[model samples]
Target: MDPYGDTLFNEQAAQVACQEIAALTLRCADDQRKAALLDLAELLEACETTPGSDVLLMGD
Candidate 1:
């Protein structure tokens, strides 16, 4: 989770991230943030199902 670099999560990590994202989405009060989390969760879930695929989080 770097703020100035890139972070990558493999299938196993993506599965865990997806679960955490789902829980965060549920607890989030802001609609915009919740929506973004949901979108990220979807991408993580996709990576979880695709072999060798990873979720690359690019930081600014």
Candidate 2:
């Protein structure tokens, strides 16, 4: 696979990881939300490394 393919996989994995982390965070205390948010941030960083012609920073 190419670098772009790898990046896509990484980004999807990061998103799934963040979703799982967020679900777990909801079961924990307020402090746990911070850690979950951190995980989501890391996922965003990974997603940023992916190159594409139609990149989105937000949805309408």
Candidate 3:
């Protein structure tokens, strides 16, 4: 089995995305600053847990 071929593997990709958003938030202009900050906060909240398939695997 090749783990590198797995589409479900994230390797903390979401965390990386959040970090990029944070950098943008710091540099966002005044007009769009509030929205950018809100976006960063929302992404942070959504990343608190890993999402799983509704159907259980054979082990479950």
Candidate 4:
């Protein structure tokens, strides 16, 4: 994971990322953070099931 560059996760990594995001979503106390995590988790899940799909994280 690079903080100064973009990160891309393929199907296999998306599955793991989605699960971790879901777990974090459950433990998050802030509603906004939870919502954002949920949205990310949803995207990761979609990427996980779609062939050749990936989740990209752009860093600032």
Candidate 5:
């Protein structure tokens, strides 16, 4: 599949992903994973660079 396909890349999807991440982080009781995830989040925030779209995905 073409990752840059129009239907797959949208602001709404990104907002949902961010919301899901916040929800999952709140529900998570695992300290290590939470820390890691938050750390990554912070690192991303600090970096001036960001991928154009769909840089990562959360999953099983």
Candidate 6:
């Protein structure tokens, strides 16, 4: 795959993972897991510092 394609695929995967984490947090009744997923979501948001093409896919 080209660099651009690879970036798109990776970004899609990250978005899917974030969605899954959010769903799990809502479905599961574990406070620790919910907290951890919330933390992960925050960290992922912080890590995305660049305002590139992925920004659109990531909801910004």
**lDDT to native, each model:** 0.90, 0.56, 0.53, 0.88, 0.56, 0.58
Cα error, residue 33 of model 3, in Å, equals 5.9
Give one digit per residue, the lDDT tens place, for model 2 in 1-60. Answer: 353433333555555656766667667767767786776666565674665322233322
Give the Cα RMSD of candidate 1.
2.2
Query: Model 4: residues >4 Å from true position, as ranges?
Result: 1-3
Instruction: Itemize residue pairs with steric clashes in candidate 6.
Output: none
Runs in model 1 deviating more than 4 A are 1-3
| lDDT tens readout by residue for model 5, 15-52 | 55556667778988999999977765554443323455
Say what the RMSD of model 2 is. 9.8
Q: Between candidates 1 and 6, which one is better according to lDDT?
A: 1
Candidate 3 lDDT tens digits, 1-60: 643443221326555656777777778778577696766556554653456312111221
Which pairs clash in model 1?
Answer: none
Clashes of 2: 0
- For residues 2-60, could you state the per-residue lDDT of candidate 6 as single tens digits? 44433332345556767777878889788888888898766555435433424223321
TM-score, model 3 to reference: 0.45
**Per-residue lDDT of model 4, residues 1-60, tens digit only:** 576898899999998888788778778999999999888888888998899998888886
- Order the candidates by lDDT, highest first: 1, 4, 6, 2, 5, 3
Taking the tens digit of each residue's C-alpha lDDT, what string does model 1 give over 1-42?
A: 466898889999999998899888889999999989988888
Error of 4 at 22 (Å): 1.6
Best candidate, TM-score-wise? 1
Superposed by TM-score, candidate 5 places the C-alpha of residue 29 at a distance from the truth, in angstroms, of 0.8
